[model samples]
Target: MKWFFKILALSLILQSFQFSDTNESPDLITSAQLETKKLEIQNYINSFSCSESGGCNYIAFGSKPCGGPKTFLVFSNSVNLVHLQEMVKNYNEMDNLHNIQTNAISDCSVPLPPTEIKCVNGICTIIN
Candidate 1:
């Protein structure tokens, strides 16, 4: 009877170890989802047209694991600049959070911002 009780206790302990907290938060965004968001933002930026260099502009985009933007995105003033800025800001914040959660590592190299943005064939292009 003592042996039976010992075995039961061992089984119970092992069963407890099998259980885990699988309740992941719904707000958690995965890398794949972030990529999708990026593509969407790029498509939106591409929708705008520019006829003059003065209408072209650039915004720092994406967060590096070590801090700073991963790159810059060129856009035209024909876009809703305020809305685009908000979207990019949110994206950067989300990306930063993802890096923290995943313990991401990077080369820690800082990306240089564009020297100028120019309208080329109705599209905003980055000039470095």
Candidate 2:
């Protein structure tokens, strides 16, 4: 009958909509995942130890929307420098992608690099 055909057509249209492609991508990183990555990097950095001021160093971290790093993180030679740098590099890249995807805004103020890095009580600390 006409009514049965109309119902069938409506069901097919609804099924098509249910299976339609969306804007979301499987590879897209969510804000929560990004935050978790940041925290993991911070915790890794915090675990570093040093016995001498000479062993302390700093690296730029995070991407600002305008340009440059959002901040600098101080670490010590006691940690695996290459591994830490690689982790930070990956984090920076992820953050940059996140900023682009979110259309992030920023004040455009560049964070100043640390004047000095020193070992304080076995931890690397930024000195002004």
lDDT of each: 0.89, 0.85
For each predicted model, how many residue pairs clash, with residues at least 3 apart or on different chains? 0, 0
Model 2 accuracy (lDDT, Cα): 0.85
97-124: candidate 2 lDDT, tens digit per residue: 8888889999999999999877889888
Best by TM-score: 1
In model 1, the Cα lDDT at residue 92 comes to 96
Report the error of model 1 at residue 26, Å.
7.3
C-alpha TM-score for every candidate? 0.77, 0.76
Lowest lDDT 10-residue stretch of candidate 2: 18-27
Model 2, stretches more than 4 Å misplaced?
1-26
Poorest 10 consecutive residues by lDDT, candidate 1: 18-27
Model 1 agreement with the true structure over 4-100: per-residue lDDT tens digits: 9999999999988865578955477699989998998999998888888458888999999999999999888888888999999999999999988
